[model samples]
Target: MAETFAPVQPDNRMAAMSIVAATCFIALSTLFAKMLTTDALGPALSPFQVSHGRFVFALLFFVVGVAVIRPRLTRPHWGLHLARTGCGWGGVTLMFAAVAFIPMADATALSFTSPVFTLIFAVVLLGETVGWVRWAAVAVALTGAAVLLRPTPESFQPAALLALGAAVAMGTENIWIKKLTRREGRLQILLVNNLVGVVIASAALLAVGWQSPTSAQWGALAGVGLSMATAQSFYINGMARADASFVAPFIYGTLVFAALYDAVIFGAVPDWVSWLGAAIIVAGALLLAWREGRKRPTRLHPVAGVVK
Candidate 1:
């Protein structure tokens, strides 16, 4: 008798695990950012500077890493690279700007809207079909977003609009990245994105007159970039190994970390209403991920002739 093995499927568990690690790093990055930028330096730098510095450092780091790992670059996918770069840079700029204004957790929750946008983009730009179930999932996510924003008499923060814009750009970028992945390597994707971000952000800062940073501030900036870079690597590695449904909700758990960091570091905390909104957002996102899992058949495809 032949031995039988269980069927394997490409679940997003690894991606979900990546989210958890990424969230932690991101929370730390936010903490360092709030401290280094405001207290250490009397003058606050614009979002352009922070974003530019982060990308420049991140790109340099990635380049060095790639040189060591020496991952083979596939044929250039210029169209996909351009699309991803354009949308990603736009989103990054907007999100960073929002961070300069709002509490980190609130901005993060707003950024969660990116997936909702991605779902719509997949259907419209990628020509992918989403059944009514997924659309309903999307609707729930939107409802959660509304709860967070709450345009009624009290709960609105205009700064959140920047985060909402970031979501749109991020959503568009996700579609472009999905397209690029067909022909490009993951590091290559990061390379193009960082390059674009550095170029665009640096150019924007030139118009406003860039601020000189203290050595400590520079160190914090570098720290932010490095933490984010490591987070990305961890996410990629983790998601490759775990089931997505098992991992995604924990990624949202980053908000808890963010809130705690904000309170301890800046004495900031979201009101009860905001907390409720965050819960709704998480619930909706969970539904979307679950629905996504149901729609796709669970079977892992071998990549580059290697079983993951």
Candidate 2:
């Protein structure tokens, strides 16, 4: 979706910081999700309801943003927005579901395989090229993911599969996002995506029989929505300034935060396999980031200040 070299602006610091900030919020979102989907808080809420709450509350935040900033709404890119929202809603719902059954670290690490899928989508859908180095990087990351999957029946966990599916869905969402960034303003992009997402999430919640959340669970759901909205903003802003692959490695920061929350709040210590798998995944992803950085230029376009 992007040029082989991203059309990066000179505000590299802002882009990098935005990605880092996104990672933090992303971890917070999943932390809340783990609480809501499990007894860590109260009666577990369904992933559909959790995801629905995510979209609704996030849309509410943007509504306030719109009322104040009053950004001149861009013409709708309906088809793209719909496709992106479908994948985003599904990916997050699957992830919220997975965190209910697996350790937050395990789910987060497996999701790290997303960039490999993002690279493949770029190559196939956009007709971009991927050299052997990138292919090798893909292999390394997949191996790490497989370590987490442990598909054999004895050690197998179906919940891990949900996280893997989320990775694919999220990776597809990444391509759509990168395409959107090159053409749209950041705030409007988020506003429209959430607008589309709330519609989808609401329909799914209805199908699943939505239930009222406990007061504590309501707070958790709000955390999912607000944190995800904030994370989405930073992620979108970062993508506007960097390639999707370039943004991928920095997201590994999320695993650290997720692991910390799990340990501190849930007291669910990670086993050796989780640590090992995550290390391998990060190694491969960071290598891809290093190569992508060396290849991308300092300034290929004037992408400074706000995307608008």
Candidate 3:
């Protein structure tokens, strides 16, 4: 008798729900960061201070999670982990800097450029072949980004540039993460990511002079931490169950959630032009995701390989 194995089936419904949950949690984290840094709010925090709190609080939550789960701690890919850590930290720092100055919707829209950057990097660095349709989609996405940026003396802000920088760094980090996922468990990756973040953020906080958060601010910080951890876990769970292409489009939900949060919390509703640009960006991203999903393995023809 031959041994049989269970067939693997993808739970797309669960994956979609997980991605939605992750987007909501991420939006909540961003909302907390915004509130904490608003000048009108008592004890308004600096960007660096907010970044430090996010990582520190997130680390504590992860530590508790690791203790409860008892996942494997040892991994052989320290170099990759270090590179990912640096990229993740750079992305986070830049994003927080942007959030300190820009509206939430604009910042979120800018960050959506990461997928476009990732596509370019895949073609250039990984030598992947992309069809002209995908290339055209990339061009459209770039145009959308330019529309949002509107490079004029009055329209162009340094914070927008920082958001783009954050996207690039995050895109690169995600590439490394894809490689790591081939060999490492999700728990291991999360542990290293949070641990590195905590260490680097602590050092930076010391260099810049740490400010003690008020009791209310502490609650906001905790919200940031809790949301970050929850979002990461939900995203990982979703990605594990569904194809990357299927899950990628759902991640755009972050933009919607961000806009809603901005409207509710800051009373800052996006104008018509911003909405139009965001729609274009979302269209381009969905096109790219559709292309990715259509990729199929080429089959060898029986007659082609035979010697006549």
Candidate 4:
């Protein structure tokens, strides 16, 4: 029988710190990605080329890690893996495109809509029951997204749409991830995701002529890969060490970090309306996480039968 880990006592402080670190790394990754497509590199690289470089470097990192770790590899449910990979690749592509054209803060804020979409998918696809409160939370989140988007002909930007599309793809990918986690190791999932991303992005690059990146651009791409992988590691560690509810609230810190990066690096500050919308979205997500935490059965210690 596969050995199960003992239920870990929640470490709120460590979890909080880990999440903050994860958020910062994520912000750094976004900053690096945006740098690749901006005048900082002289002529901006194409979004596809940037995406290709990111996945290529990320895959190289994962391959080296895998060689060192030598994790057990299992082949189960390849179809679902492919589906999840497709959704994730699509999300990453759209997100990079959004970052190229939109403010980092806006793109990050809109990405939070993934959890709301995940809730909807859970209800419809997973046959999970969502009560009135959760529904209300979803509605509030959507309203916030609309407030940020502001959909006027003069105000609307297509990049905003791309961000939302990324959210939806990520949400669907999240559902698949939930299913896969029941049967796969973390490294296995990540390996497949990066591998597929590299393949898809490489194919896309072929269609659009690969642009040779300068030395500085190469450094930025390396940063993107390293930061992204480290961010995922930090986030997973944080969530594993603490309750999901506790860790989830801290995940919203990504928006704050992204906003700060936007201001400091890009000199673009979001307007008051955008800030308000971000607040609303964070509020709704917190509520949803709280409710979901309550719904989950508390794990009990084997000897004492006391909740851990």
TM-score of each: 0.73, 0.78, 0.73, 0.73
Between candidates 1 and 2, name the one with more favorable lDDT.
2
> Which candidate has the highest TM-score of all?
2
Q: Quantify all predictions' global Cα lDDT against the true fold.
A: 0.65, 0.75, 0.70, 0.71
Report the number of clashing residue pairs per model. Answer: 13, 0, 0, 0
lDDT of 3: 0.70
lDDT of 2 by residue, 130-213 (tens): 777667666776676556444344223867888889999989998898788766667878999998888887888889897778
Which pairs of residues collide in model 2? none
Better of 1 and 2 by TM-score: 2
What is candidate 3's CA lDDT for residue 93? 78
lDDT of 3 by residue, 192-293 (tens): 777888888888888889777888888898888889888988876665544443454566567657767877777978788757766775686567556655
Q: Sorted by lDDT, highest first, which candidate order results?
A: 2, 4, 3, 1
Model 2 residue runs over 4 Å out of place are: 1-17, 92-112, 136-166, 271-273, 293-298, 303-308
Tens digit per residue, CA lDDT, model 4, 1-308: 23332333445566557777988898789889889988797579987888788778878888898899987777756777888889988887787788778775577567667767777777677665667766766666666665755544422386788888998997787567655654566666677777888888889999999778899999998988888878866765565455433343455556657777888887988899878867876776567556655654455565443564
Best candidate, lDDT: 2
